[model samples]
Target: MLGIGIVGLGYWGPNLVRNFSAAAEAEVRCVADRDAARLQKIHSLYPAVDLLSEATEVFQRSDIDAVVLATPINTHFPLAKMALEAGKHVLVEKPLATSRAEVLELMEIADRKGLQLMVDHTFLYTGAVQKIKSLVDSGELGELQYFDSTRINLGLFNPNWSVIWDLAVHDLSIFDYISSGKKPVAVSATGISHTQMGIEDIAYISLFFNDSTIAHITSSWISPVKIRKTMIGGSKKMVIYDDVEPTEKIKIYDSGFSVSSPEDMHRWLVDYRFGDIAIPKIAQTEALLGVAQDFVSAIVRGTRPISDRESGLNVVTILEAAQQSVKQRGQTVSLV
Candidate 1:
């Protein structure tokens, strides 16, 4: 069994503890949090696991082979670097780091140490997304056309990062995974702050790809109601992914339009094909568990995971460009 240590039991840490506790090929040996109540709460569930007050203690443990970080956005780079320097495999929560330089440095460390460096992009492990990847790769959704997404929820604002960093990362990871060969070349974004923190609470991002493909993401922390929906449109079919829907998360619509022969150059006929909507069944499994399993397996088997450092780089690249675009008042930012 691979021994694991977790740091930061804030918003998303407890969930990681729960999943890693139940995950395959791994065991939570130690966990640390500055919040005494958080440590006590986790101790209540896991009496056998060691609890520490300082995060540095997690890296000092001799038995722990891997470290999982759920710290704030700014602390990811330093904590992960410390773990890697101590010869421990590391898993960090999304975006990898605040800037590309930090991520590249962490990648360099992990490479030198020959350790697994993974990002906890939990959405990439979801059954619905995995199914969507299959559909996309199988040519079920003909030539890719567009990816439009809206991920908005209420009242979970962060002082460190804006809505674009907090929310759009998910959609970008999903897009990067599903659209294999097609990558965005440029990005444009706009956002506004609604609180005294001067952090953006709402944003809109548009991505331009080399081909005819494009993507638009609307992310907000001010929505009255929660919405996790995405549409992947192609020439032959379209997909509707409603993450909030428990049962019918993925619905494939076999409907699209086609161009008819043009008798006159200016007057071309159009035909619309409306076919049946197919709802493919998705396995009901917690995505975090898959993340835990992949982390452990990659460490043991010496294989790069699905959410590897390279994929994490892709997500971070777009995030950096998008944030710059927002700062420039929706000026298009070149990614390449």
Candidate 2:
């Protein structure tokens, strides 16, 4: 059994602890939080679970075979590096690190130590997303044209990172996974900060890829109501994945544009073909739970996670570039 140590008991930490504790292959050995009151509260709920104030104490214990980091964005790099160096497998939340160099360093350390390093990109493990991946992989999304997404919420603001890192990272990771091996060539972005927090509350990012593929992502935390939707358009078909919907969460539309006749030239008009819309029977499972379970499986099988370090690195690399672009007033940034 993998003995796990959980760091940070803030917003997302408890979910990790609960899921990890429930996984059969792993056991939550201890949990650490800086706030003593929060630790007491957790101890009150999970009486048998060990709780501590200092995060370093978890690393000091030999019983911990792995560490799960649910800390803030800035703390991810150092905490993950420390955990890996302590000879423990590490699982960190999304955007693995703030910078590309930090990601490379973490990869090197984990590789040298022959340890597993996983990132919690929770959405990728979702039933809807997995089905979408299968559809794309099976050529149902044929010759991808563009990916457009809009993710907005009222306010779960962060002081460290802008809206791009806070919100668009999810779509970026999804696009990365869905696009397979396609690397983005260039990008442009713009953002606005409504508050005095010094970080952006809204942003729009455009990603340019080789060939005809391109993607646009818009994220904001200042919206009135939450909206989570993504559309992937292709030559053959199109897809609409809406998390806000209950019945039609994922709808694959067998409808697209087609040229009527090349001979007509200027007279020729684009045809709109509409056919079947499939929801592709999907299993009901919590995304975070699936991610936690997958982490354990990857550890046991000695395999890289689906949303592994490399995937997280790619997302962070884009985020870094986008941040730079935002600062430069949406000047096109090149990834190559």
Candidate 3:
């Protein structure tokens, strides 16, 4: 059985503990948090698991085969590096690190240590996203034209990270995973710091790919209602994935219009196609559960996780570029 230690019993840590506890081949042996109150809560709720206020306790434990880090974005690199160096497989929460350099360092360290390094990109593990990836890979979506996503919420903002890193990273990771390794060439972004915090609360980012694929991510913590929606339009079909939906989270629209201008030799004609919108019946499963299962499976079998360190690095690079662009007041930042 895989004994896992979870760090940071903050917002996402409890979910990780719950999921890891539920994994068949894994056990949440230990959980660490700096907050004494949080540690007491965990101890009270999870009586079977050992709880500690110091993260070092879990890290130093010999029984912990793997460590799940749900700490802040800035601390991710250090904690993950320590875990990896301590001969423990690591599962870090999104963005991997604050910058690309740290990401490369962690990847290199994990490679040298020959330990499993997985990023917790929970959205990519969802059934809706997996089904959409199937459509894209099967050529059913045709050549991808544009991917637009909006992830916004009210009042759950983190002072440590910007809106782009806090919310936009979700769409960015989703875009990266669904694109099947297509790298964005450049990015332009704009953001506003509303709360006098150094971090941004609202932001819009545009990612340009070599192919005609362009992805736009808009995130805000000032919105009245939470919006988690993504639309992917292609030459053949269009798709909509709504995380807020309770029943059908993904809907594929077989509707597209084509236009040919006089400049083109094809002649000046407009083609319109309309078809039924099919909501693919996707199985209901918690994303965190799937992520936990994958993380443990990777540790036990020495298999690469879907959201490995490289994938995490890719998402972080885009975020870093986007932030750079934002700092320059929407100047286009080249990824190359």
Candidate 4:
């Protein structure tokens, strides 16, 4: 089994620990957190696992073949770099790093060390998203025309990053994955800070692709109601993904419009067609478990993971461009 060490026990750390512990090919051998209470709680639940107050101990231990980092956003690059330098595979939480340079540095280290460097983009492993990817890849959705996503909730303000970095990052990853090899050419964004913390609580981003495809994302931390929805429009069909729905999370619409030439030279006839909507049944496996399995498999098989360094780099590049656009007051920033 691949021995795994986890850093951080707050927020999303516990889920990682649970999934890694349950993975058949992997085991959570060590857990490190500065918070004494969190360590105590982990020890109480998992007495066989080693607990460390300092995360550096996790890197020093030779038994740990891999390390999963669920630490704060600012700590990801340093911790990942240290792990890769120590010859340990690394799985880090999303956005990879705040800047493209940091991500490239980590990627270079991982490549030199021949270690598996994966990013924990949990949403990509979700059943709904998996189904959506299948549909897109199978040409069932035809050529994608536009992608629009909205993810907003109240009172989960992050101190280190703005709403765009915190929330829009998810949609960016999703867009990157479903778009396959298509890359965004330009980005425009706008955001505002409402709290005394001086961090943005609401933001909007728009991405432009070379195929004339467009994507818009809206992220907010002060919405009255929670919403996690994405709309993908194509030439032949459309899709609506509502993450909050319990049973039916994905609905595919067989609807589109067509045009016909009229006798008049200046006027043409437009035809609209609305067909049946189909809801595909999705498996209900836990997404974190899938992520854990993929991480361990990548390490053992010496293969690139679904959420590898390149994917992380793409997401981070978009985020960097969006941040620039926001700073320039919604001026379109070129991603080229």
Candidate 5:
């Protein structure tokens, strides 16, 4: 089994530990956190696993084959860089790094060391997203025209990053994965800081593609109700994925309209077509477990993971552009 060390014991860290421990091809050998209480808790639960207050021990240990980082956004680059430089494969949480340059630097080190660098864009491994990818690839949803997403919740704000970096990164990664390598030409974004921390609590972002395909992401930390929803429209069919639903989370609508020119001048004809809606049954599985397995497989088999470094870079590029646009008061930023 591949020995794994996890850094960070906060919010998402525990989940990573659980999933990596349950992975058949990997073992959790050590955990590190700044909080002594958190380390004590981990020790109580996993006494055999080593615990450290400083993460340097994890990078120094020869027994660890890989390191998984679930720390703050700002700490990602340095920690991942240290792990890669230590001749160990690294898996980090979403967005990879704050800037494209940081991501590129990490990529260079991993490439030079022949180590696997994977990002934990966990939603890409979900049944709903996988099904959407299959349909889009199969042309069932012919020529995807738009992707709209709304992810909002109350009071999970971070001190280091804005709401877009916190929430919309998920949708951005999803858009990047299901789009199958389609690159956007430009981006426009607007946001506001409602709290004293000076970080955005609400934001909206729009992306433009070369083919005129568009994507919009709405994220907020001020919503009274939590919602996780996305809509994908294509030439032939459309999909509605509601993650909050208990069952039948994926619904496809065979509905569309078409327009044609008329014989008379200044006149046109339009037709609307409505067909039966189909709800596809999605296979239920733990997405984090899938992420852990993929990371292990990438390390062992020398295969690229679904959420590889390039995909993470793609998401970061868009995010960087979006942040610039936000700073310019919603000015459109060209990605070209």
Candidate 6:
């Protein structure tokens, strides 16, 4: 059995513990958090697992083959580096690190130590995303032209990271996984800081690809109603993925448009096509469980998981560009 150690029992940490415990081929050996209250709470729920306030103690353990870091985005690099140097496989939460340089350093250490390094982009493991990938890969949604998403909630504004870093990463990661065409070459963004913290609480980001494909993401912490919706339009069919829906999360529409210019005149003719909507069945399994299983499997089998370090870097690359663009008041920033 693979021994797993988890650090940080904050928002998503407990869910990581629960999923890792439930995953096959893995044992939740230990969990660490600085807060005494969080430790006591976890102990009350999972009495069999050991607890520690110091993260290094968990890394020093003999049984822990891998360490999962659910700490703040800023602390990801140092914790992961320590775990890697300690000869432990590391699973880090989204964005990997604050910058591309940090991610590169972690990737280098993991490679040198022959350890499995993965980012916990949990949505990639979801049934909805997997199905969307299949549809795009199979040409069910032929020649994807645009991808648009909106992820917003009323509260939980991050103190350290911007709204783009906290929320836009999800849509970016999802787009990175599902799209097989030319990667994004530039980004343009505009954001607002609502508080004195100077951290962006709301943002609108747009990505330009080498191909005709384009993507737009709107992330905010000030919306009155929570929404998680993505739209992917293609030449043949379009997809609407509403993560808020308990069931029927994916809806495929056989809809598209066409335009052509006459030989003699300069005006163009436009036509639109509308067809039936299909809602394919999606697996109801917990996405976090899949993330746990894949992380463990990658370590044991020496394979690449869906959300590998490279994928994380790709998403971060876009984010880095978006950050620069936002600083320039939505000026387009070239990726290359």
Give the Cα lDDT of each candidate. 0.93, 0.89, 0.90, 0.92, 0.92, 0.92
Candidate number that wins on lDDT, 4 or 5: 5
Model 1 C-alpha lDDT per residue in residues 1-336, reported as the tens digit of each score: 999999999989999999999988889999999999999999999999999988789998899999999999999999999999999999999979988889999999999999999999999899999999999999999988999999998978999899988999999999988986356889999999988998999999999988899899999999999999999998989999999998999999999999988888998888988999999999889999999999999999987688888778888888999999898999999978
lDDT of 6 by residue, 1-336 (tens): 999999999999999999998999899989999998998888999999999998899899999999999999989999999999999999999989888888999999998999999998889989999999999999889998999999999989889889999999999999999984347888999998989999889999999987888899999999999999999998899999999999999999999988886776777787999999999999999998988999988988877799889888888888888888888999999887
The total number of steric clashes, by the backbone 3 Å criterion, in model 2 comes to 0
Model 2's alpha-carbon lDDT is 0.89
Q: Which ten residues in a row have the lowest lDDT in candidate 1?
A: 176-185
Candidate 5, residue 4: lDDT: 97
Model 4 lDDT tens row, 1-336: 898999999988988998998998888999999999999988988999999988789999999999999999999999999999989999999979999999999988988998989998889999999999999999999899999999999979998799987899899999888988578999999998997887889999999988769999999999999999999998889999999999899999999987786788778878898999999999899999998999998988876677777889999999999989998999999988
Q: Candidate 5's residue-wise lDDT over 65-123, tens digit each?
A: 99999999999999999999989899999879999999999999998999999999999
| Candidate 3 lDDT, 1-336, residue by residue in tens | 988999999988999988998898998999999898988888888899988877778889999999999988889998988888999999999878989999899888888998888899999889999999999999999888999999988978788889899888889888888888789999999998987777889999999877778999999999999999999998999999999999889999998988876787867788989999999999788999999999988888877788878788899999999999999999999998
Give all TM-scores, in the order shown: 0.98, 0.97, 0.97, 0.98, 0.98, 0.98
Score candidate 1 by lDDT.
Answer: 0.93
Q: Give residue 53's lDDT in candidate 4 (0 to 100).
A: 84
The parts of candidate 2 lying over 4 Å away from their true place are 260-269
Overlapping backbone residue pairs in candidate 1 total: 0
Of 1 and 2, the candidate ranking higher by lDDT: 1
- TM-score of candidate 1 on Cα atoms, chains taken together: 0.98
Candidates 1 and 3, the one with greater lDDT: 1
The lowest-lDDT stretch of 10 consecutive residues in candidate 4 is 301-310
List the pairs of residues colliding in candidate 1. Answer: none
List residue ranges in candidate 1 displaced over 4 A.
261-265
- The lDDT, on a scale of 0 to 1, for candidate 5 is 0.92
Tens digits of per-residue lDDT, candidate 2, 1-336, equal: 999999999989999988997888898989999998878877887888899887789988999999999999999999999999999989999879999999999999999999999888888988888888888899978888999999999989888788898889999999989877578999999998988887999999999987899899999999999999999998898999998987678989999988777675678878889999887777678888888888898888876678888789889999999999999989999999
